[model samples]
Target: MPGPVSLAEQVKEVWTSDEGSMAKDTASNRWPKIVQGMVDDVAETAATAVDRPQQEEALSIQAALKEIKDDMLQNRVLRPLPSDGRDDIDGYNERLEQLGGKCTWLACPWLFGECYLYRRVQTIFALTHHWRDYDIFKRQKDSTFAKSCKAVEELSARYMQVIANSTLPGDATNEEARKLLFVEMTEVALWGNATDLSLLSNLSLDQIQSLQGREAIAKSQRNIVDNDTDAVWQYLSSPLRFNRRIDIVLDNAGFEFFTDVIYAAYLLESGLASVIVFHVKDFPWFVSDVIAADVESLFQHLESASIFPNRSFIDQVVPRLRAHFDSGAMSIKQHSFWTTAYSFHQMKALAPGLFKSLQVSSMVIFKGDLNYRKLTKDGLWPHTTPFKDAIGSMGAESGIKVLALRTNKSDTCVGVESQERVDALNEEAPHGVWIRNGKYAVVSFSDGEKTDGK
Candidate 1:
C-alpha cells in the first residue's frame, strides 16, 4: 500500500478534487493545449521510466491528473468558499508560505504553472468535496528546474561584443573608458531579462533556432516594468563606471542559476568588474532561487548536453560555459539577502556586509520577479511614487548603482512616470491587467547618489 501522505503531499492533493481548480481555469484560458500536451507527455514518460521513489510519485501524479482533467471537462463546481472569496484567497496564500518553508531546495517552479498542485487544488473543491482551498505550493516546489538548450550559447555570443567593450583595458585610465564601462555594466544588467528559460520547455530551452529573430528582443521589452523602456535599454548598454564590485541578487536555480553564473563569469571575463558577489536566500525561497543542491545541479547543466540535441551545438557551447568556471572569471557568494520578506527596506538590516560590498562593484543587478517584488514592496505603493523613493534609503545608503530588469509579477511596479506612458500601454493593450502580467516590464535604474527620486 502507498505510505500515508506527508503534510507536503496532503497539501498537494488538491487535484483529487474540484476545490483546487484555479490552475485548471488559468491553464485552459492561457495554455490549454500546451498544458494538456505536457500532461500527456508526462504520462507517456512515466510509463517508460524505471521504478524509483520519484518515478512512482510521478506515476501517481499522472493518475491524479486524469481526474482533475475530467473535473474541468465536466465543469465541476468546487466548494472552496467560492473561488473568489477572501477565505479561499487567504487559504491559498497561507498554504504557499507554509509549503514555502517545507522545501528550501528551490525545486517548486511548477506550483503556479505546471506540476499538479494547481490542477489538484481546482479539483479539491468539487461540490462533493467540502469547500476548501487546495494547497498549491507542492507542485510549485517540484517543477523548479529542468533541461536547457542552445539559448545559453547563442546568448553568450549575442552579448560578446557588448561584454568585451564594457571592460577596462590594462593601463587605460581614461575617464571616458571608465564611464563607458559603467554604461556597459549597467546595460548588461538591463539585458539580464533577454532570456530566461526557467519556465520554458526543455525543447524550447535547447533549440538554438529558438533564439533567432526579434522575438527574443520583443519578449524582453514586453516584460519591461514601470514603462521606462528607454531607460531600460539605455541602462543595458550603459556603464556603471563607479569604483565598486558587482552584486547579483539572484533568483531560481538549476539552469537559471547556471545562466546567472554565466552572466557573472562574463562580467569578469570581459574585465568589466573586479569582484562579483551573488546574493542567495539563506533558506528555501520563492522556489528555484538557490540551494546547496543547486550548485552541483548547475555544474551538471553546464557540463551536460546543452539544450540543443545536435552534437555540434553541444561541442561549441561546452567549451565556453566550461571556460567561464575554469578560469575563475566568476565566484559565487551566498548570503541571506532574500529572507527580509516582502520589503527590501530591510535589505540593509539583513545583510549589512552586502551593502558594504556593493561599494566595490560598479553596479548591482537584482535578478528575477521576487527580488523586484521586495524592492517595490509588492507594488503596493500609491502608484505615483518614484522608484527611488519606493526603494528608499536602501540603495541611497550605500551609493550603489541599482538596476533591475524585472517582469511585473507581484504588485510593486514603478518607473512609469507619465499618464502618457499609461495611455500608450492602454492603446497597445487595452486591458488593465497589463500591469500585473509579466508581458509588460520596466527596467528601473536608480543611482544611489541621485536624490532626484528616480
Candidate 2:
C-alpha cells in the first residue's frame, strides 16, 4: 500500500511567517497570551472550587496550560496530540508526524501551529473528569458580549423594525430595496467580526463600539477590500433560490453571532431562503468560535432585561427567532470536521460527509477570518487569484455555492481585483495593516462563472 502524501506536497508550503504579517505576531505573542488567559481562568476557578477533587482537576489543567505557554515561549518542538477519542485527533497527529515531529511552536506552519494550540488546550480539559465540559473562554465571550450592548440594542431594534416592515404590503417587494437591505444586513454580520477575542485579547468597549456601532456602518462599507455581496445577493435572489436552504458556517459567539442570527432571520423574512442551518463547532475553539451551546446563550442574552434595558425591542424579535428553531425553519448542527486543523480543500476527502452535506445547501457561507484562512489554505494564493481558484475544489462547480463574508484579519488574502490597488493600499497605509487589521473586509462569492480550475 502507498503511504500518505507529504505535507510539503500538500499545498506548496503551509506557510509560516515570522514577520510582515499576523502569523508572526500570533506565534510570538498572541498564542502565549491566549494560553495565559486559560491558566488564569483555571487558577481563579480552582480557588472557589466546590470540592477538593474539582479544585485539584482545575489546578492540573492550569499547570498544563502553563506548560503549553512555556513551550511557545521556548519554541519547543510540536508534540503529537494525545488520544482524546475524537476522530479529528489522528488528522492533527498525522500532520505533526509528517513534519518529522520536529516542528516547533514558532517555526512550524502558522495555521497548523495556531490550530494546534487550541486543540492542545481542549485535550487538557477533555481528559479531565471535572473539567471535561468546561469552557475557560466563556467568561471572555460573555464579557465581550456585555460590552456590545450598544450594537446589540441597535440590532434588536432594527430586527424588530425589519420584521414589522417585512409584513407590510409592498415592503421590500422591489429588487432595489431587497438588495439594499442585503448590503445593510451583510455588513452588520461582517463588521461584528472585528471584536474577535482570540485576536484582540484585550479588546475594549470603545474598540468594540468603533467596529459594531450603527453610525459607522456606512463609512466602513468602503473598507470591504473585495465586495462580492452583489454576487451573493444575485444567487440568493434567483428564481431557483425559492424554498432553498442556507447554511452559515458560524464564527464568534457574542455580538458577531447575534448579527448572524439577525442575518438568518433576514434570509427567511425576505423569502430568499426557507430554512437556515448553522454549522457550529462541537467544542470550544479558537477563543470565541461558536460552540453549539453559545447559540442558546446568545438568545438568553438577547432576552436579558439587564443586558438590553429595552424589553420592547427584544420582545418584538426574540420570540420569532426562537420560533424558527422550534419550527425547524432554522437549525444548528455541530460537526467535528469544523474543529479539525485540515484546510477546507481537504474537506471533500477527509470529511466526505460534511462535504456532501454542504453541497446540498443553496449557499454555504463561511464566516470570519479563520474559516476564510482554511478556505484559502492559509494565504497560499497571490493577491490577484480569483476567489474560486483560491479555494480549490470548494469553489464553483463543486455543487456548493460559497459566499465568504470575511473581515481580513490575517496575511492570507485573495480575490482582490487589482494588484495595483493592493500596492496602493500597502504604500498608503501602514505596513500589512490592510490585511492584518480587521477594518478591511471581503465579500467573495463563487459560482460556475469562472472555469479555471474547477
Candidate 3:
C-alpha cells in the first residue's frame, strides 16, 4: 500500500508557478494562486468534515463546492489558459464544471449522498454554481455505480443458479469439464471489475452465484467456507513461490480492501497465483483512490474486528487472511501507475516493459473505478460501445486477460446495446443521474488479442 502526500504537500506542488507549452495558462503567475486558493478551500473543508459530524458535515461540504464555483468564475477557469491543441483545458474546465454540478446533486441524501468523493466535490461547486452548469455531477451522482451493482447482482444470481444445479458442466474430471471451468474462470475474470462496489456490500460472489433456494445467502456463505482454495490458497498463503509473483492493480483501501483480501485468499487457496503485487499512484489520486498506506489501515481494521459492528462475520474471515499474510502466502509491492501524468497511452510509451513484465503473471487484477475511467479514456461514446473498443489499443494489445468490473462513474461507458435502452434510461432517470447513481456496469474482458501466432 502507498501513502498519499498530505494536502499541504500537494498544495506546495500544484501552487508553484510553472511555465511550459503544457501549462494550463500561458502565464504561470496567476494560475498558481487560483489553483492554490481552490486547494486551500478543499483542505479547509476536509478539516471541517473531519472535525464536525451529523448536521454540520453538510454545511462543510457545501462550503467546499462554493469555493470551486467561485474560483471557476473568477479565475476564468472555463476558458483554456494555454496548452497544445491536443490538451483541452477548456473542455476539461467545462467537464469540471459539469462534474462540480453533479457533486451538488450527490449532496441529496436520497441518492448516493454518503459517497465521500461526490460530497467533497459537490462542496466545491455548490458554493460557486456556474450559470451554464447543467448539473453534470448531479446526473452522474444519481447513476454511475448503481448500474454495475445491479448487473453484478444479476450475474451473481445466474452463476449461483449454475452452481446449484451441479450440472454446471464443469465439475467433472472430464475434458468438457475442463473447458467449462475455463469459461467459468474467464467469466470470473470478467466480473473482476477491479472497482465494482457489490463486493463491499453483503453481495459476495458466492452469494451472487447462489441466488436461489430458501437459504441462498446462507448457501453462499457456506460455499465460501467449504470451497477448498488450496491451490489459490497456497499462492495467497505463501505468494512468493520461490520465483512467482502476483500483481494487484489496487482500488479504494478501506473496507474495499476486506473484499479484495477475501478474493486474494481464494486465489491463494485455489493455487491460481503466487506473490501479490499492488500497483498504486504516486500522488493523491481520484480523491479516495487507494495509496499504499491503506494496507496498514486495512490491517488495523481486521486486527480489531471487535470494533466493527459486524464483528462475527469479520471474525470468521479475518483470520484466514491474516494466516496467509503471516505465513508469507502473500507479499505486497507498489508501483506509481495511477498518476495524472501517465494516461493509458502514456503508460504504453513509458512503461511498456512494466506491462510486459506483468504479462508473465498467472493473473493480474486491476481494481476500482479510477482505473476503469483511465482504461476507457473517459470519452463520450454511446453506451453500447464495445468494451474492447472503448479501452482502445492498450487493452487490446496486452497479452493478458484484462477483466474490468466497474460501476459507471464517468461519461465513457460500454456493454449496453440499443439506443432505445439508453434513451429510455435517460428519459426515466433524472437529469444526468445515470452516471452518478452506479446503476450501470460493464463486466468487460479482453484477451490481449495476441496475434503473434503463439
What's the lDDT for residue 3 in model 2?
Answer: 94
Superposition TM-score, candidate 1 onto the true structure = 0.56
Query: Model-by-model lDDT, in order?
Result: 0.49, 0.79, 0.44
Best by TM-score: 2
Q: Whose lDDT is greatest here?
A: 2
lDDT of 1: 0.49
lDDT of 2: 0.79
Model 3 Cα lDDT, one tens digit per residue, 304-367: 5243443444455556667887887775665544443223544656567776766776555666
TM-score of each: 0.56, 0.90, 0.52
User: Which residue runs does candidate 1 get wrong by more than 4 Å?
Assistant: 1-147, 157-243, 306-329, 340-342, 359-361
- The Cα RMSD of model 3 versus the native structure comes to 14.3
Sort by lDDT, top down from the best: 2, 1, 3
lDDT of 3: 0.44
